[model samples]
Target: METQIAFAFDSAQVANRFLNALKSSGIDNLKAKLFRGSEKVIVSYCYEDKGFDQTAATLDDLASRYDGCEISIR
Candidate 1:
């Protein structure tokens, strides 16, 4: 099964940094994309169920570092 997480960050710059940090962690079978809004950037992440916990934790850690970052699982 595949799991998905959607969330928002303060800005596209923050979103980019988040994605870069995520990719740098070297997780496999991961996919992510970002959508820009006037004020906030929305990010959608998808990965295998096997890696869901680790990926979610990584996202939580990364999100904490940025302002107005929050994860909304769907």
Candidate 2:
């Protein structure tokens, strides 16, 4: 299974913070990219046997922790 999460923030600093939080979550199957101009971070994950709900929950938690951050999952 594969999941892609796009995070948009008010500033680059906030976006970097969110990216750090995602990396520290210890999800091994994830990849992240930062788009400075748009102040967004894109995270892509590939899991062998996991459901999307778990990923969504994790992302939701991260968003709650970071102010001015919005997430869209695809």
Highest lDDT scorer: 2
1-74: candidate 2 lDDT, tens digit per residue: 67777778778888888888888897777888785455788878775573444775677678667764545543
- TM accuracy, model 2: 0.73
User: Ten-residue segment with the worst summed lDDT in candidate 1?
Assistant: 36-45
**Model 2, global lDDT:** 0.72
TM-score of each: 0.63, 0.73
lDDT of 1 by residue, 31-70 (tens): 7667445334344445555643666677667667765455
Please state the error at residue 24 of candidate 2 in Å.
1.2
How far residue 11's Cα lies from its native spot in candidate 2, in Å, is 0.8
lDDT per model, in order?
0.61, 0.72
Candidate 1 error regions (>4 Å): 36-52, 71-74
